[model samples]
Target: MSESSQSRPVKVTVTGAAGNIAYSLLWRIASGDVFGKDVPVELALLEIPAATRAAEGVAMELGDSAFPLLCGITVTDSADTAFDGANAAFLVGAKPRGKGMERADLLAENGRIFGPQGKAIGEHAASDIKVVVVGNPANTNALIAAHHAQDVPAERFTALMRLDHNRALSQLAQKLDCQVGDLSRVAVWGNHSATQFPDLTFAEVAGSPVDVDQSWYTDEFIPRVAKRGAEIIDVRGSSSAASAASAAVDHMRDWVQGSDGWATAAVVSDGSYGVDEGLIAGFPTIARDGRYEIVQGLELSDFQRQRIEASVAELRAEREAVGDLLG
Candidate 1:
């Protein structure tokens, strides 16, 4: 749309296009909110066969919205078709935990979904394709996908921890009686689950070190951020949609463009802070040249170390449960 357009349209494939999160995310991306106005994007909407028709309806709405940078749209039930030539992908479709379902059951169900999709991405997507897993059990789902997508660099596969990162920021902002923009360097470590640790050890507000009460940080702030999704579902009668979509956009945008400061993402660990190597765990990260690098060498207090270790153990157990699926 702009005269100074620098490159061809990025082909982005989004699974679960018929769902609420995708519903919110598609509009943001199509409107050039993620990739900027000067860059164009073509969307490949992937849905299950039962949901393909709904995905088509969503495409029709996109057409009606008249997004200037949306060059194309394709709705498909096939993962191979969806990932074809894709430069970016958001794996948002996974089996949700139904009544009476155990955690292992959820992991195996999602592994079945992501493994095939990952293989499809490996065979079909562009060489530089980057992927984000937005579905529940996201960290392990990403690990499964990365294992199957052997051709794609494992580091390119990340889970959506930015949502937790943002939750931590918002909670801390409220506690400090300051705007969210006034905060910097807040990092979420470990799984994007109840075990997550939203560390403010190095956080700053208005260029000053954060000095919140220790009991508040331990008793209120950490659990609040870690379990925010469950809290949202409890209060709203449904899981988060728009906020999750926004965080996905934030994570992908930072990965594609760059981060202004430290952002939290669930990237494959290189054993930083004693997280298991290859575990997709949340860490303080910076993006540059379209790659996320974990911010290393930060001192961890004993409490923080224990919090992180507990989450990593959960991640290890998950990997074991899906051992049959991984290569």
Candidate 2:
């Protein structure tokens, strides 16, 4: 906890340090892009035992970068070691869905990975640790992690829905010929999968409410944003890594620094927007003072409601599939 002129150097743990997404993420974090330029960080990078050598290689690269805000680095294969005293964690490790694999199989595999990590986090992480799951099946993985981490407040666990949020922003920007930054209040609701609803029902472009054709919103915009991952894979022959990493940074940055306005994140629902209680569902959120609250009083149109319900239903099925892991 060494203090710089700005703030104490906080310990941040990142799982799956050797993976593509984490490879993109670590340099950004070490350079203080996720935190602030003045706020230093001690990175605890975790990989599986087989990837320990690769993790060390990453540490070597970080050393070469010589980032001013990077106070220290620890590379390990053990969750307990990685999470010990961690002020923040990115649960980026999970079994990816392979070719011909069913959704149920993917959920079960990730459950095995996240369950123990969650328990370790509950026992070893800092009292105020904030966690975000960047792994596949993220929303339900987050739900599993939060369920196991009883010692940590459930509100601290979130899944990355910022990717979907950003995708919606970009698609809208492309359609309207506006800068992505010019749009605000773009909400991504429900799961991170194809079922996610990128609700522009309340969005504004350049300080004016956007009124667009309903057909375009439904037929083109929503599907494009929802399936952006597949589109990336089709173009690149790989899953999204850099964009996912960037979105994770955005999610955590706004979370730690306070989003000036609305952002979308998958947080454990307090029954907001009729989402089932205890489910980690994406919703319009505000991050302030190092905590997130689901934005209240946004009236959902019937279309939005039905879309969110479909996504939540998928989440519910995922939960039931991993029911044994919840304990």
Candidate 3:
């Protein structure tokens, strides 16, 4: 905490501090892209025991940057240590699906990682702690974390669907020849995987509805945004790094500071739009006063309903696979 600042420094903990995404993400939070330029941040970075040295090196770089808003840094291998007294947390580390690995295996492995971390968060984090899970299969990972964190409100936990949301915006912008800012009510629904539906039903540019061919929306836009991560991996030879980091920043920033228009995020479903209760599913929401209220009563076309149902089915399957790990 700095006396010159308006408030105490936000203790923001980030997992996987040694990874590429964290490398980009740390700078954003430290330099105040997340909580605003005036708000100070005390960063607590978490890594596995084997990556401790590498995390320390990253900390050294942060020191060199001399970001004015970064008041303190703590690099540790202990989740308890990383989350203790934290105000916000980014759960970004998970086992990547290796070649020939089954989906069930991946879910079980990530369950083990998030389960204990969630317990630690419940035990050690601040009462108002907000968590965003950013690893692969983020929605399920978030569900496991939230289920284990019995004391924390389930609404406080979310997964990063902002990447999908942003990807949809960019793809639409390119097609419509409009700035991304011109598009409003653009949303991504369902899983963050290829099954996600990039809804153009309500998209508008300059306050006018986007009038594009239905074939382009289905054949080109949907798959493009849904498969963008794999496309990035194919070209860049790495999973999305900077873009994923940027989306994480956007998700947390909007959640903390609020947003003016609709923002898409994967939150615990309250049976909205027929999504099963207790499942973490993507939805369009309004964030205000540090809370997200799911947009209600939008009439879905039959096609939209079917698409969302398929994605939610995937989420339900994931939950079932990791049922034993849920606390």
- Please state every model's RMSD to the true fold in angstroms: 1.6, 1.6, 1.7
Question: Which candidate number has the best lDDT?
Answer: 1
**Per-residue lDDT of candidate 1, residues 1-327 (tens digit):** 234433689899999999999999999999888888778899999999999999999999999999889999999999999999998999998899999999999999999999999999999999989999999899999999999886799998999999999999999999899999999999999998899989999999999999989999999999899988899999999999999999999999999888889999999999889999999999999998899999988988899899999999999999999999985
Report lDDT per candidate: 0.94, 0.92, 0.91
Ranked by TM-score, top first: 1, 3, 2
Q: Which residue pairs collide, candidate 2?
A: none
- Per-model TM-score, in order, reads 0.98, 0.97, 0.98
lDDT comparing candidate 1 with the true structure: 0.94
Top-down lDDT ranking = 1, 2, 3
User: For model 2, what is the alpha-carbon lDDT of residue 92?
Assistant: 94
- Residue range with the least summed lDDT across 10 consecutive positions in model 2: 1-10
Candidate number with the higher lDDT (1 or 2): 1
Q: Give me candidate 2's TM-score against the actual structure.
A: 0.97
